[model samples]
Target chain A: MIDPSGWDLPSLTDRWRSATPFGHVAIDDLVARAALDELRQGVSKEPHWPNRGEIFEMMASGPPQQPTPRAFLEALGGPAVRDALAAITGYRLQRVDGNSYVYLAGSYLLPHTDHRPGVDRRIAYVYYLSPEGAFTGGELDLYRCTTDGSGDIVATEIAATLAPRPNRLLLFDVGLTTLHQVREVTGGARISLAGWFY
Target chain B: MLALHRDVLSTDERAQLRATLDAAGWSAHDLADRLHLATANAGADDALFARLLDLANRTTRPLRLRAFQWLRLRRGDYQLLKHDARERPPAAHVELIVDLSAAATGEAELVYTDGGATLFYVPQLPGSVAVIERPPALLRYQRYLCLRVADAEVHRLRLTLA
Candidate 1:
């Protein structure tokens, strides 16, 4: 059901294993165009709850119970996909948790290392649903952080940035150094399927 | 930064401190109703904070230490954050917050790519106070208090004490 029709997983996994800072991989046109269009339509129709907090801004919908979302989830949670991800990251794949975010203008996610106790989130991924160039200023910025002489966590600089494009999938492990934030959306809407493989 | 006064609070200052603490404890809802985002009137609260800071810093004062300890337990991660134009870090500032949980301890300093470094670490025990002296040159300076606790027991001491 995932329609992994485009990606060459073996090659992609190798690149991820050797990438800098920590292991991560990405691919564009991840889902088949027609299937994605249908999924987008189904996702847009769901009731969303607005999240307004110091650390996050955007609308969120719980994981789907219906078929469209179920199929998408099925693909991610499927054995082939899970095994490929595990082989790439050198971690066991027990489950994949999924949700979605709808970020409109002025919404942003501030910096935080997404490490919480009891949630053994090994890998985090985002499947872009919004078209590229349809919006501006919603790039995922990853920071290079270190504890300075004083013992405070200082984000020295932005090491990598990934712009959102429709049907692109981004996978990054939840390492101690994995500090990232979503820059404020200056205009229009940016939607994406967010998940974590644990 | 908290200005410490080694001298005891004057009668008038003590009365003011009691009144202010009582207002903060009782009229909290009323005050919140009138509060605006990112704005607060420190008023006499500054002096009280300075006094409390002074009391906590003097290791020899056990009575004052216990009082300050009680305040910390009652008020979780308590802080008075301000960004007045007059008291600000110079360009290349890093506002740092270190949480003061009873058993937690540590500090951090950041060095910019230019080789210039600024210290933003605060003492890591309860009642430790420090101020952000400048805004960072590259990124937005974040103002906050980080409360580090050793265990859940330390976090729930307020209930036990009450």
Candidate 2:
């Protein structure tokens, strides 16, 4: 059974609708045991070859590349999350692509946008899996892009960040107005599942 | 801002061009000339040039509706270069990584550059996504973080192509 406790879906839908540049709806305890077990088994495994600039950092490149499978991604953006997305946009959702990253202590992620040019990205969903007390200082920053020229306040927008919440998922539109990046993980490992919806 | 040129380049292509422009110190006039040439030889010269010119004009205009199409496509790199040129730093180049365990706890660092070598983070970099802040207690009900930096500085670094 799915629980909507602590979440006001109706209000969240409105938030998504009224969001500037981009908006996000978050899920708590998104990672269930079944999902985590599947993810653990699939660690270090690579998905099919990503098209162009689709693949960023390679987990397999690290000291030990774990085996991650399609099931892992599906678990990250599971039925519950998809249902929420469908409710928000009134459209069925599909997983465009998914990837994962692992950060050890003292490691940091340079700030950057996810989807590249010419890519057909619609929505982006991210799930954080940092072990409790295992690390510190990893956060996702979402920026609202605006233009201020001369003495005029021509344009304004909103940008929000979601901290590293264990078993939490964040869903948002990946449009131009949605400018986001991840901050470096300071002390421990920060694992995440990020991909887009077409 | 400029109007949506009927012949505005594809969103992806436009984004690529914008990233290139940001890195190369190119201008609208330069982009306009290139757009003209790119569309001129594509066989539908008039329609394409008209669109390009429209885009240039609309983007130059203040309102975002004029550039909504590109915006929908998430052409932020271009939008920043064309529109937010003068905004100062606090802007950042963030690269997100998912750990092998698929967790959100890990160590990461910011590396700045100036067309030469990937420079180290400096207080003098003009702008940077320097720090992360804790959310207000009222908002702690959810997981989230915010970055601080000058908007101008984020654009100042210009993207370095692969």
Candidate 3:
């Protein structure tokens, strides 16, 4: 259900390549209004568990089992969506997988590049589903990195911060320099369907 | 495996050590998302080292101190498991962490894991110490010090023995 008007391959390609700190593009109203509502309702009913680790603390759902979310994910992996993203980002993406994430009060994800050797992840995407004014402080922070001669990250500084606005979709290239994090959710819940385009 | 020794240091001893560390030169270690904390080299404290060594020999095995350091974590600081340098294969060592904070914050914790399952935990309790045996495949990390704990400070004396 991606809007065709905003999917202009030539313009999006330029924007993605020139984005600061790394390659990324943020598109508002990425999907039709009706589909967004259906996806949100379906995701709210899915079972979620507290997923925590050294770098992250948040609630996460497994792969979608409901019809609506399942269908939405399938659509994303289909040729229409995949081809559009491939044209813009220039990554030879073959498939997509996703899960629903809920960042509640005090939840956060520290800075990390989504790069994992041999995992085949090419692009990372987040579709924000939090209603307008539903949350505060859960911004997506991108960091500009200073790497050594060996291409190892040694220092970093905040380059950009994207609010978790409803109906917004963020897609970015994943590599050694794509350092990003989710700022802590201070007040309300920040919900989204996030995963990788592999 | 882990063993907690509560009230290991008296109030005066804790205060003295805190003062010493407070006055020591610290080096900030930052790597974007992996870790952000200050560390300093602590001078040799023979009596305390001997006590910890004796405790470890009694609890786990005979070992000698390899190194020790002072770690200070303020708000918004953390050390992730992936960033721990002790993750080398065939891990064989015992680690001791002595909490020397001015007050107990109960926010930061040292967590040991194996194959993604938690094996041991050490909380930030003033005057308490934790002795943990590092088996092969064992991983450890300090939980993030969140901003909600206003102005809370965590000072830990970490010792490695082999």
Docking class of 3: medium
Segments in model 2 whose C-alpha atoms lie over 4 Å from true places: A1-11, A18-21, A44-69, A75-83, A90-92, A115-117, A148-158, B1-162
CAPRI classification of candidate 1? incorrect
Top candidate (DockQ): 3
The DockQ-derived docking category for candidate 2 is incorrect
Q: Model 1 — TM-score against the truth?
A: 0.56
Error of 2 at A1 (Å): 12
Weakest lDDT window of 10 consecutive positions for candidate 2 chain A: A49-58
Report the C-alpha lDDT of model 3 over B59-141, residue by residue, as the tens digit.
88889888888899998888877677533335578889999887877689888887488877898899888998887678888
Q: What is model 1's DockQ versus the real complex?
A: 0.03
1 against 2, candidate with superior TM-score = 1
Residue B145 miss distance in model 3 (angstroms) = 2.0
Q: Give a tens-digit lDDT track for model 2, residues A29-75.
A: 75466666556455535332322111122232222234444555554
Answer with 1 or 3, whichever has the higher TM-score. 3
Residues A1-198, candidate 1: write the lDDT tens digits: 564534576788788887655677887777788888888887887767897543456899888755677688788988878877776778888888888788887666765566667889988898888866777778887766665687454334567788788888888878655777787777888988887888
TM-score to native of every candidate shown: 0.56, 0.45, 0.90
Best by lDDT: 3
